[model samples]
Target: MMTTYLERASHALALVCRVVAGIALVALLAVTIADVSTRYLYRLTEGAIALRVTGSVELVSYLMLCSLLAAMAANVEKSQVVVEAFSHGLAPAIKNRLHGVYLLGFAALGLVLFLGLVDSAQSAAGHGEVTQDLRLPMSPIYYAAAALSLLLGVRSLIEALLGALFGRDAEVSHGE
Candidate 1:
């Protein structure tokens, strides 16, 4: 009963994350398109006068990066694309064991990503790098990406571990 509750809660969280991330991605795309159009229109209106355009591209890049980070976390949760081609022939117990091994691997990956996050944060601090136009410390964005990646890794590990320990319903929808 506890497992079921946890699973349901995790699924709910994934759904919310997915919706928010998807909206951000769409908004970023629209913003990028608008920026391009605006710049082109400005060039035409200005007529051979080059205006020193400053931050739109940088802003767009940061927004896109953030969207990508969010999307990745959502993708890991809605992991539907499993390779069961050979697993079909295996016994149930063996399949569960194999899945457990996979979960361990995912946990290891999570550890690696967590370590990378530390390194990235330290490097950013040492360099004092900031965005060209926004002047925001680039370290924070890197840290955000690292944190999201770690979250994704943890989600995968949890799914794999749960499936291995309690088995999984093949019919359960992996929808975020």
Candidate 2:
């Protein structure tokens, strides 16, 4: 069967999110290693190197948050936890409809989170919120998080609709 534009878009979005999340994780790892190495060098050289990363803590924290939010969409799409005890006895059609309802509910929750994040981003921007160490603006991170939430929301909605229309077969697969 031919793929829909929405499916293509969802796939693209998931790919992008996963890629970003991977990059963020790598960056976090690299930063942590660098920070630890610097600290060790400082201790060994008795302040000769003196090359402490001034904002390493704040930078790592931001990277962690970014990695988490960036992975959210792909996780929601592909790795949702299932309770087989609750679904094992149901007919496939019933199970699928239940899944659809669950997806829709998730989508609604995502939408609420997205809106709240947007508001928080705006407030942070207005207040000129910044990291104490780096003085990095917080609004951009919030905005990125809001965008990821929106992406998850839309992807969930689309999956829900497909499930409603096509039953079990319409459910999104990890292969996509």
Task: In model 1, state the lDDT of residue 65.
Answer: 68
Q: Rate the local accuracy (lDDT) of all candidates.
A: 0.66, 0.77
Q: Give per-residue CA lDDT, model 1, range 28-110, as digits (tens).
A: 77777777777787789885644443576786776676676567555553334457897878876666556655665655676
**For candidate 2, lDDT tens digit of each residue in 1-176?**
32365566666777788898999999999999999999999999998988987799888998897788778776665544569999889787776667667788769977998999999999999999987898989899889888878877877777666555556434345464
Scored by lDDT, the top model is: 2
Tell me how far the alpha carbon of residue 135 in candidate 1 is from the true structure, in angstroms, after superposition.
Answer: 2.8
Off by over 4 Å in 2: 1-3, 168-172
Each prediction's TM-score versus the true structure: 0.74, 0.86
Candidate 1: which pairs clash?
A: none
Superposed Cα deviation of residue 4, candidate 1 (Å):
1.2
The numbered model that scores best in TM-score is: 2
